[model samples]
Target: MIQELNDEQLERYGRHILLDEIGYEGQLLLAQKRVAIIGLGGLGSPVALYLASAGIGQLTLIDFDQVDLSNLQRQLIHNQQRVGQNKAISAQQSVELLNKNVKTETITTKLTDDELLKITKQHDLVLDCSDNFETRYQLNRICHKCQIPLVSGAAIRWEGQVTTYDFRKNKQPCYQCLFPLKSNQGSIQESCSQNGVIAPLLGIIGSIQALEAIKCLLELPTLAGKLTIIDGLTMELRQFNITQDLSCPVCS
Candidate 1:
């Protein structure tokens, strides 16, 4: 049951409501949507903040890691005082501080396949901000089964990428379709901790992830079936078309 915007909400989101693309009705729609963000690190930080601030009714944050002093470089949702706190809880506190009206749920442990499927079924959308390919593959499978839209983002070194998988649409590719599991098997995965990413690089990619999530919720144009890549070194942006693999094990 979506509620009408109160006077306070109207004032709080006046700029969004004023936009022709997202008017009063759109604001109300945003206020009624539920989102689940997996991983509370660099990418999840801005995605959570922007979504909560944009008036998302509920957000479920999932992460198993604790904040470290070293995370402050890119994880903006946590502070010095919160070092050692669970990342999900830290992000929850930050979201509440930004917007008390938005409800937040925290899952501080790794979720099994069944657990992930059950939780994702209850949300309007899912954001795959997890760092590892295993988690990303699991999320892609669950979201495809549940037919939920997924906004995926990744950043390493000076390169970043973002894409959306609208499972509601037929013939659209899932994440696995783009990068097959066999090809990724036994591959060396690089981490920001090892390779080092520019602080603002994650900011740029994560912010765009938030924007894509908003557009998906608002039924605006999104990067569905398209991949957007960013080269922070030369500031070059490029887009590539992604097609569904007819033999995709997950989505076929």
Candidate 2:
């Protein structure tokens, strides 16, 4: 059931309302949307802030890591004061401060497949901001099973990529389609801790993730089956087509 926006919501979202693309009806639609962010780290920071500010009805923030002093450089949702707090809890507080309208669920423990599927079924979309391949593959499989859209991003050492896999749409590529499991050992763990990332690179990638997520929620054009690569060092932007792998273990 759709709830009417109060006077405050009308006033709060006036700018969005002014746009022809997102008039009153679109704003109303956004208020009924639910989004889940799989991590509260570098890439998840801006995604959460923007979605919260945009008035997404509900947000699920999942992160088992705690905020560290080193995380302050790139993770904007956490601050110096929250250095030792769990990232999901810290992010929830940040969202509350940004927009009280968005209901948030904070999860601090790693989720099993059953737990993930249960939560995935409750939301409209999922954004992958995790650091490791294990988490990404897990999210991909669950989202594929649920037939919901997944917007995923990765940033490390001045380079980043963002993509959307809309399992709701038939014949689209999934995450594993783009990066197949090649070796006996999983993909190399090329983390920022091992190789430092520039402060602003995450913002660029995460902002795109947020934008694409909104598009998905709004039923607009998305980057499904496309990978956007951004290089901060050379300032080069490129997009490559991601075809559905015939043997894509998940999507096909």
Candidate 3:
């Protein structure tokens, strides 16, 4: 059942409430949802900010890194003053500043697969804003097992991609289905640190991740089986259908 919105909440989310697609009922749904963001870097920054601003009742931030001067280039949730602080804690502080009504929690240590599965089971949605394929693969397996939706985003160099895996829906493709784990074995993974990334590229990708998470929480239509790719240099956007792998191990 949706809780009644207080005066402050009503005023704070007035714009969202005005939308026919996201009326007062939707706002209340948002206010009751719990979302876990598993990274606090470039992509995770905007995802955390927007979700907190949207009044997600609970946010669990998981990251083990510290804010560094180099992170300021794209990680907007942290400032120079916060350098050397745990990224998850820093993100929690930012979220509190954005909306104190949104409860925030931080996990400053890296999680093992079991730990990740246990914690993610407590949330309504999981946002895979982590930087590596190993984390993405593990999260996909866990979310698929738990039947929770996962919104995944990545930005590196001048390109980025966003996709959703609504594991609640049978036959839906997951991150592992799209990029088979075996295929990535022994492959070198490029990161923003290695290849360098355009600052705004993260904002674009992270914003989409946030939007996808909101839609998932509000029970609206989402890009559950499609990948949206963006070419920052040419400003071109493209989307492709993702099919579940019949013999795949994760979500088959």
What residue pairs clash in candidate 1, if any at all?
none
Residue by residue across 53-118, what tens digits does model 1's lDDT show?
A: 999999999999999999999999999999999999999999999998899999999999999999
Candidate with maximal lDDT: 1
Error of 3 at 201 (Å): 0.5
What clash count goes with each model?
0, 0, 0
What TM-score fits each model?
0.98, 0.97, 0.97
Between candidates 1 and 2, the one scoring higher on lDDT is 1
Error of 3 at 11 (Å): 0.6
List the lowest-lDDT window of 10 residues for candidate 2. Answer: 181-190
The runs of at least 3 residues in candidate 2 whose Cα sits more than 4 Å from the true structure, single-residue gaps closed, are 183-186
What is the alpha-carbon RMSD of candidate 2 to the true structure? 1.2
Each prediction's whole-model lDDT (CA): 0.94, 0.92, 0.92
Per-residue lDDT for 145-201 in model 2, tens only?
999999999988989999999999889898888888775144467678888999899
Q: For model 2, what is the error of residue 21's alpha carbon versus the real structure, in angstroms, after optimal superposition?
A: 1.7
* Residue 9, model 1: Cα distance from true site in angstroms: 0.5
